[model samples]
Target: SRILLQDTSAVPTSPWTHFVMMAGSTLRKVKSRSWKKQRHFRLLEDGMTIWYKSRWAGKGHSTFSVTEVEAVREGHQSEVLLSIAEEFPADLCFTLVFHGRQGNLDLVADSPEEAQAWIQGVRKLIHKVQTMDEKERLDQWVWDWFQKADKNKDGKMNFKEVRKLLKMMNVDMNEDHALHLFTMADKSESGSLEIEQFVHFYKILTQRDEVWKVFQDYSGDGEKLMLEELENFLMMGQQEGERSAQLAQELIDSYEPSESGAMSLDGFQKYLCSQEGSIFKPEQRDLHQDMSQPLSHYFISSSHNTYLLEDQLRGQSSLEAYIQALKRGCRCVEVDCWDGSDGEPIVYHGHTLTSKILFKDVISTVKEYAFKASDFPVILSLENHCGVEQQTIMAEHLSQILGDMLLTTVLDGQVPQQLPSPQELKGKILLKAKKIGGLEDCIDETLTDEVSDEEEANGDAESPSAEDPPAESLTENDKVKPRKSKSKLSKELSDLVLYCKSVHFHGFEQARLHGKCYEMSSFSESKAKRLAKEAGTDFVQYNTRQLSRIYPSGLRTDSSNYNPQDMWNVGCQIVALNFQTAGLEMDLSDGLFRQNGGCGYVLKPDFMRDGNTQFSPEKPEERPDYKPLRLSIQVISGQQLPKVNQKEGSIVDPLVRVEIYGVPQDQAKEETSHINNNGFNPVWNETLNFILHTPELTLVRFVVEDYDKASRNDFIGQFTLPFTCIQAGYRHIHLLSKDGTPIPPSSIFVNISISELT
Candidate 1:
């Protein structure tokens, strides 16, 4: 079954060999300033390993495992910078980077086709190994169950024994179904089944059930679906007019094997598991949300501690973080400015071992990459820690780098009652920091008097008087305290805070009654939650005209993020998240913002923006005019599911979960199903239903997960869409990666139905 090739000389002649073999004399292994004097190399073990001979006698011969290869990409000849002591002429080479390898393995190929063959062959071999691993696990599971069900000392399982086995596997079988399986397995019409017969019976039973369920869901009456019905189901309102029927006919012709105009169960299953079966109509979709709302009226994509690539402390801070965050459509970035040893101010996590980058360099990077991905405004959440002198330099650098793009004055001549819309602030940068009412008010009167008197009486005052205590005589506790300095904002930076001026939140009443133009406030997650609980109505009312930001708590040293939906429910616009971490919370954030062409802004719903409406996240009251809608989702199957990672002997037990998030009454109602060991073509045949009170404000998310017995379930992929956008009927749901990019050829088949409740 398996064959190993030691070198290019001994090639296996078996056509059914487990691995493909390729031998070439031009192949040379290059590593670390020297080419292994090896001219002959052989790709063996299904491309999972490679062997090379240094001499004709194979004296210096070795092999390396290719299963742990990280990347295999094309390499240029110019990349060979070292002097080649050996006289060997190589045409082209490709590099292979392994997980724990010290240096890259560069192999020479005679032609482009040869290099491509190796690359493609290795990728296919890896996939085959993964498939075999999954098969082995499933086979072992079936054998264990068979052994347990044998009960008696016989090597075969009788009808009663088979029934018991079905019950243990959670399949409720009737006499008719039981007899059908027994007759199919017992080829000699015997009353018992041998081991081979049992295995064959188990595979057929699961496959047939899956096929029939899909057929029943599509075709009513449990028979084969007619051509017209198949066309209608696949179209599912995606195609328009008579063209849909024609397209459906074309699909049937391609998938259907028989001349009969009716589609069989096998044909139906094949079509459902293909890329053509996907229900996501990309053409009908459009970013039609209103973009004229005020900047505060939209939920912005924000990042907390944007400089840190890891933990809050002992993390490496770099300008590249800003570049990455901006490229990912983050409109709001945090900058913690502290005094650097050099004259320039630096950005880093204060009171920690985090590295620093020049504030000017950060500003320059932001200026270059700010509008590259999104043209909307960028809000610099400046956490000022530097003194007045360095703060002035920060303002100067921002002014010089940002030039005319910085907001130096109010959009209109007069201060409006509400903040300006994002459309009005397009391509502009806003600074958010503590507002210094006036420069003179920040200085202590005593310190000012001392300075003024010293300058007025130039050199006339004595260094020390007899009444003054001697410096050496005073103890540490008795020493005079140094005057504490107040933080002051320069006029240049203060002027730039035309819209995003940071202010302290006193209380609900004060902020509501006296909040003015450009006076925004921020809250930590804990404090924000507390405020939402105690004064939900007041917080929502205050945010109607002002902007509020919520960030992760200080206790989250791992730079983890809190759930943003809770904050969004309370009308918080800037709910900052740790962009570096990837998890369910980050997935939800990414899914929510995948709309509007990922411009990093989603408009708040009507109820939250309307001041006259009284809405609270803590309380729920029935809307007399608003009717509830029932949503039904049938989890069918998945196709070409991706592996979480490329490691040897890895398998995914995939499951699907449907979730609904909205107001308190319509809050997260989720139902999860069991996992199928077969990740490639898993069929759940489970139906989930939900009653949605606020369909307009609710979001529906479908998450695929991998079940693990000993650890938490790993996320496979997920896709989300607003409730209003979901179309009813048999449709395919295309899954998206955590970063919101479409994973091609990976999708889930589902039938969705929505009905209004009386």
Candidate 2:
């Protein structure tokens, strides 16, 4: 192989010396007097240049001469160099080798695994001689090769000559073997090796005594190192290694693949290799794709169980729940965001503040959780329940905090100005619109209200009365009616489909998670068609139970029917993740099914081994019942509503209370009251049905007639209702009394109505 030199030996005595690297045969000796001016030498080939300078030479006033001491090999060039250093350095001091110099050593490895193993072995050798105590033995061994390989007594070895010597010695003629020699010989790599080439190559191959010694220095006593230990080592090295970890971080931060911030393990491994070497041959590297190959990495519990962040993270107070979710094996973390007035993003599940949780340190906690990226490298699919502007602000905040490290997607809103642009992160930002419709809208407001009255009547409104029974379920053999409709799936969801395509366009690994099931049918058709037509990136996601049920006939995963994988190559892709748990029964007491619980299920680790694994039995344990509904009322109008306090004349909206009639006489007296003038002003709004009272009242009364009829659907019984209104705030009013109570009046009653402020 050809070698390049950065400095010339004649400059050794100068304050700062330089080495002139060129084709071994083209190098000329520098005149002693010209040493001061020859601080550096460069080798040029095909308009590319490799420079060698005094800076590359060790701390002493010493140098080496580059010369062609061997004949060129059939497809390789070899060089030889004579060193005149005061003392041998701890490590091998040679230049780099270039592919152009190899000529014909173009033996390629079909798989990346083969290439990685071969390269790692060579790197180990270089490290051993650098930090160990066998410097003298290493130096002597190399020098001996130099003398033995100078076949013509010309003090230089050429490429062809080196190959001839290897053949003469019966060396194994393999790509790995050839690479070892080439790397040692062409350090500066001016495309040809000189005396130094043969010297380094021979020592690396023939120095049996020092080979094992080098391995011992870097090995962990023949045991594999823990990941944490390796991580620490990597971090430390990045901080203080030859190239510095900062450079690697910068490169990673600046990278923008069209689709995602998450790099596949395979892709990242190649990146790591490239950072160390001059070139990265991903095809030849043994890349680990285990972590990123799954379509979906989320773990679901078959049972209704609630898992709290406190239960995970093993007790790291500062860690966010989302971060803990990753530790718990949840590959997809769903975050519900509502825009705040200040443009800040808030995470909460309910539609209003009374049902919300506000963490004072939410932002900082999120940052900590976000730092543990890659655990869920796909989209942090954010559901926006507020205004579009607020959603945009949230996206902006996320981008500012995460930079290029987070693959964030906000659903149902236009992107905000503050967030990193798709241009900035190289398309890391993803947007998916919500899909709503079909059976979702079937649960109308009246139906929801009827659904909520089961406890009151001590009976459920039966599904489709016997006289007018429910319609027969449709089947595959049945004829279906055609209807004109747009998929209820929102633009945000559509954007996700597009985003995945974009990721593939930019050559990145991609994934997604679809939780809603209402528009499944239409979504499946349109998204699949669009992805096939537009975005060509692969989609790896865990389908909901509903989706899987629809897939066989609806999605057609078989290649014969739909070549989803082909879509990836063509710029569209789809991969369904299996999530069938045939036998795991979860405890309802585990809180998984709580209205706003963190996780909707829980399972043992063994159950999560594979998609096909069944859950084992749990020991008998205590169970808890906590699903009882809690009720409170709000005033949308009248005097009980939110007050406009103008000290001189404070005005408040009216109060509306729905009182239940049944319990003790004392309780009835405590709860009932007569509507005094202060409360029965007669001014009303649709939301004000109960009696309104002044702020000074201890209690007031409402005469509600025929209240019993409200308790039953399709029933005609009616009873009087009476209510007491105290000076409680709008939110404190009674919407429903968990335990039925009595009222004062015997004939009066009231009606309830839903209200919207605007």
For model 2, the run of ten residues with the poorest summed lDDT: 581-590
Candidates' lDDT values, in order?
Answer: 0.67, 0.27
For model 1, residues 1-758, the per-residue Cα lDDT tens digits are: 01011111222234323322464445666653554445666674223456667667547767765444544545442133122423333325555644321244667666655655665555554454344432343454566568657767477988888876765553544679778878988997788998889988877775746557656766866667787777666565333346667867776787777888878776775565454554534422445567787776788999888887678878878664676678678999999988888889999888889988788878877887788767889999998777777988998998888899888766666656778888888898988876544222323212221222212221111111122232234454443233244234455555555677676555666666676746777777776777777777777777877898888877787888887877877788888998777666777676677667677888887777876557776664543346679998888777556777444235567888888877667766555565644555677878888988767667788998888888888788888776766756667787877655555446787877788886
lDDT per residue (tens digit) for residues 1-758 in model 2: 02211211111121111111232111122222222222333433211222344544575332221111111111111111112112212121222222111111111122333322222322332333333322343344345435545566665556655655454332324556666677666787654456656656654554322213322333355232223333333345222234334444443444322233333322232322231311111121222223222222222221000112221112212222343333222223334455555656555533322223222223333444332322223233333455545544554555565455544343223322122211232323332223222122332312221211211221111111122111123332221322222112222222222222110010111112322321111123234444333332122121211111001112222211222222111211112211111101111111111111222221112222233322111110111211111122222211111112223222222223333221111112212222222111212223323222111111122212111223421111111111121112111111111111111111111222222222
Q: List the candidate 1 regions with Cα displacement exceeding 4 Å.
A: 1-231, 234-285, 438-485, 623-625, 643-650, 736-744
RMSD of each: 13.4, 35.0
How far is 338's C-alpha from truth in model 2 (Å)? 2.6
Pairs of residues clashing in candidate 1: 279-732
Q: Highest lDDT: which candidate?
A: 1
